[model samples]
Structures are given as structure tokens and as C-alpha cells.
Target: MSKARDFILDIFMPTRCPCCEGFIKWDKLLCEECERALEPVDNSNEVPPAGCSAAVSAFKYDGAAKQGIYALKDGWGISFAVYTAPLLAEKLKGCGADLITCVPMAKRKANERGYNQAEVIAKELSKLMGIPYDGGLLTRRTTSMAQHDLETASERAEFAKTLYGIADGHSDITGKKLLLADDIHTTGATLSECAGRLLSMGASDIIAVTLCRTVKEK
Candidate 1:
């Protein structure tokens, strides 16, 4: 039955580059150069007090990376999650954990989009990493104002105050490792805010993995 389902999907939905909209080779998700182009977030010497670790993105958010992210978020190219998950997995090599939690959306956005793109990436990453995925650990409240449009760090900090965590009474993660997943990382205000929430909840450790990271021009 599973094989039949895959066969049907293959025929009806051929995989393609989320950016270029061209066919992605059967076994390869992104082309070689695309894989090498991702920039890792700098956590080398500036580790957080918390045991949290992070893997860099495969591409800097520029040409192809920008297009791929925009395609998934705006173009409704949901299958892009499947193609990008393996790359996340490769960057995540040697990291093992008990639960995979995704960056959640505001309830309204999730309902309107019919899904959270981050949740989709987390599900695919779960399959690749052989870890169970949980969507309930963190929840986002109503939409905060756009962070990009803000002119000052104070404005960004004010927006960060809007993100809060809601726990669903599930398995306990105290002393257990967690892989926090997301689709992209901008100023990281969102991820940092979420991480702060998790630490407050007794989550012992965290490893953040995102499909892409925004590069600020110097």
C-alpha cells in the first residue's frame, strides 16, 4: 500500500526545484553547488550559556535560496520541504535527539495556509533523522507586526516581546536533547525568543536547524 501511494505521487507530482521550478534529479535534492553555497550561522566561539547548538544553512539567502524560500512560502510549492529536509539532515549529522519540534505559526496563519511550512520541514526531518516529531511544544500567538519594516532595534525588541510559548502536556523533555526546526532565520529574533521560552520550560538542551539563514550585509 505504501509503495502504491508513492508510485501514485510520483506520477502525479514530479519533484522540482522550488526556486527554478525545474526538475530535481531523482536521488539528488539540490544540485551540488547549491548544497555547498549554504552559510552556517556563527555559533563557534559565541556559544549560548544554554547547551543549545545550531547548524548553518546550506545556502546564504541570496539568489537560489531566496527564490526557494519565496516559492515555498508564497508559491504554494509545499513539496519543497521534502527536497530540503535531506540537506538539513546532512548538516545535522552526528546530532541525535529524542524529539523534533518545528517553529510554529500564529494560529490564524496556520489555519489560513492549511499548514505550517516549518511543521512540514520538521515532519520530513523526523523521517530522515529517525526522530519523533512534535508540533505542540511551542505555539505562536496572533501575528505581530512585520519585523523587517521596523527601523530600530528597539522596535525589533518590542516585536520580540510578542512571541510566547504554550506547552501541551505531552512527553517530558527535561534533560533530553531537542532539535528545533524552522524554515528560515532572519535577525533570529523569532528563534531567540522561542529558545528563551523553551529554556524557561526546563528543556535541557536545544539544537536549532533551519533551511536558510538571512545574511546581513556588512
Candidate 2:
């Protein structure tokens, strides 16, 4: 039944490049123009959040990365995950993760959006890594404002905390290495708060992976 469903969906809904929808083939992530506009993130220049053991993003969040991310998050361009996840997974190769998980969204918000973009990307990452993904391991509360909506670091931090908790009766992660996924990393407040909650529940390590990381505002 699942195979049939996927086959039907594939026929009716073809994948398109989020950044250049009209200029790409089905298997391409982006057109030549959009690809050339991307500035890939360098590992040495990247910085992790307070509670994260490490962090990485596949591309610097600008130009094509910016357009692709928005299209995936708000424009039903989920196929962007197929092109983006492989790049992100390459960064996670050496990071010994016991399991994979995504920075989850609140139930209501996820319902409203039809899907969580982070979870979509995470699932693809898990497949590429041969890692297990447990999407139900965490829960969050919807916030009135997104991290991008907040101006100060303190405001973003406050909203990030108390929003996620280890799922009830599923808290046996002592000494386990966890890899958390998200669509973008800006202030890192959101992922840090999620890590804080898991570490308090006995998770030994947390590494964050995101599709893009924003350029710091000067």
C-alpha cells in the first residue's frame, strides 16, 4: 500500500528545484545559475551553539540557499530535501550518532504547515547515513513568534527553552549520542534549547546539522 501511494504521488507531483523551478531537470537540485550563486559553508569557520557538541551546515544561508530554503519551508518545495540532505549528511559522517532526530515543531504548527521541513530533511539524512530516525522522541510548544521574528538573542533563547521536552516514557538515552536536524541555523537558540532538555534527561552528546547557516549580521 505504501509503495502504491508513493508511486501515485510521484506521478502526480514532480520534483522541482526550489531556487529555480523552471530551469532544472527532475534529478537536479538547482540550475547552473543558482548553483554557482551558492557559497558553501566552511567547517573551520562554523561555530556550534552553547550546548551543542558540534554543528554544521551544508551551505551558507544566502542567495540560492536563501531562496531554496524559503521555497521548501513555505512553498511546498519539499523535494529540496533530496538535493540538500546528501550534502548535509557528508558533514555528519564522522560524528558517531546513536540515532537521528529533528528539531521538532509544535503539533498545531506542523499541522498547519502540512509538514515540518526539518523533519523532512532529517528523514532524508537518516536514510543516507543508515541511521535510525525517531521522530516521536520529542515534542514542542508553538511560539507566538519565530526566531527570525525576535531581535535580541535573549528573546530567542527564552522562546526556545521550555518549548521542547523529552517525550514521556521515552527518556532512556543515557550515554547515547544524538544528532539533531533542523532546516536552518541562525542564532542557534532553538537547537541549543533542545539540546539542553535532552542532556538534562541523560543524553551524552548532541550534534546539530542544518541545511544552511545564516551569515552573522554586522
| Most accurate candidate by TM-score | 2
Candidate 1 wrongly placed segments (more than 4 Å): 1-16, 22-51, 168-170
Model 1 clash pairs are 38-58, 38-59, 40-56
> How high is the lDDT of residue 56 in model 1?
44
Winning model by lDDT: 2
Query: Which ten-residue region of model 1 has the weakest summed lDDT?
Result: 42-51
Tens digits of per-residue lDDT for model 1 on 1-218? 26566456657776566666777654445565655554544434332322356644545677777777887786465655666778778877777677888777887877777788888888989999899998888777786565678877567767866866666785567776788777876666666777777767777767877777766677
lDDT of 2 by residue, 68-155 (tens): 8988888477766667898878877878898888888888888888999989988898899998887877888777767778798899
Indicate the TM-score of model 2: 0.88
RMSD of each: 3.6, 2.7
Compared with the true structure, all predictions reach lDDT values of: 0.69, 0.81
